[model samples]
Target: MPVWPFKRSKADIDAKRLLEAVTQTSRQPALFGEGRIPDTLEGRFELMALNASLALIRLREAQGVESLAQAFTDKLFRLWDAGLREDGVGDLVVPKRMRKLAASFYGRLSAYGEALTSPEALATVIARNVFAAEAHAFAPALAAYAARTAETQAGGELDALFTSEGWPAYQG
Candidate 1:
């Protein structure tokens, strides 16, 4: 069989599917509103980072499919980059913006990981990142939701990441 230059690898396809699931979950309206995540661009980005971080955390612990995780992350960033372009962000400035976005994502990932150890810490982190405030009344609810998601993903099969049903429903 001849090599097909344009064919996507299995990992790439799986990653795309997983990314789609993450994106759809992040965009659920229930996640945004008064006492919930803000519906602005920054708020959307924060939610995406949170959902993606949860999936990546589970992926890191799985025995195999490490490449799938990497592929998922690569596709995610590409999607963000495309969105930036669509918004008329100049090519000359996309790199700087992406770098800042990446930094924000990684910082959230670290804070979330550490915060997961305690409910109070998790709420604090959620208030800080998701709500962008010192203390939001609904931050604790969001924290509980995140904790539930992490637990669900931890017990789910790797294939679950590719489907919406794999993630816990948002109760916010």
Candidate 2:
């Protein structure tokens, strides 16, 4: 059988769907405002990173889904690359920016993964990363939301986790 250039692998398709779900959840209007996540680009990226990290954490835990998790991460970075180019980032600087973004994302993933076991730590992480402050009034609520989301994903079916409506509703 000949390979079709346009044909995507199953992992790719699943990853795309998962990424879409994550993006949709992160972009929810209720997640942003004066008392919630900020409405700035940094805030948006932070929210996206947070959601993606949660998905990745679940994927990593699921049996025989390592490839899917890797694909999801690859597709996410690719989207970020395209977005950067679309935003007028020159080719010369794209790599540098991507590196920075990757470092930030990985750092968050580590911090969040470690902090997830503790509510206070999670709240502190959210306040520092999402709100860019030492302690934000909404950090506890956001942390609670993250905890609830993590629990939902942990108990959800893998197939359902990749769907657009897979994530729990954000009441923030």
Candidate 3:
């Protein structure tokens, strides 16, 4: 729960700022240039991956641990796949509306898939929701989703605290 270098809230992360940075960094003759959009799935993943890697480095430093890259990578992928599911047992349930929007974006950008095969693909995944108007507005929810996902996938600890077969269990 260390705050990002930019700000305390995700809103502070500023999609516009991120877009501008990406735009500037990926300009022609730059590594990420040529038909790249910072708002795409692949683009977002790349951003997320970078951020995650940075966070892991910070975490290791704080804990005074030796290279945690492998552990960090393993946990990150698990959290990435679990993706916001607080409950360890179920699929990561994306909101129907968001899912549709994502599908639409993906479909529109499908043609760019080949062009996105670069390292940018990593951040693109993390930044997947960056383009969603609702995302900036609901960043807490998204963070919660990501936190829950990571916790659930990390181990069985949180599971006991959240679920209950109490009273009338849905034994159906």
Best by lDDT: 2
lDDT of 3 by residue, 66-107 (tens): 333344444444444454354343453545534553454444
Each prediction's Cα lDDT score?
0.88, 0.89, 0.35
Per-residue lDDT tens digits for candidate 2, residues 87-160, read 89999999999999999999999999999999999999999988778999999988998998888888878887
Residue by residue across 1-172, what tens digits does model 1's lDDT show? Answer: 7687588889999999999999998988888887677888888898999899988888888887888989998999999999899989999999999999999999998898888879899999989988778898988988898899888888888888888767888875
Worst 10 residues of 1 by lDDT: 163-172
Candidate 1 TM-score, true structure as reference: 0.93
Q: Which stretches of candidate 3 lie over 4 Å from their true place?
A: 1-37, 65-72, 82-172
Give the TM-scores of the predictions, in the order they appear: 0.93, 0.93, 0.24
lDDT of candidate 3 at residue 125, scale 0 to 100: 36
Which scores greater on TM-score, model 2 or model 3? Answer: 2
C-alpha-based local distance difference test score of model 1? 0.88
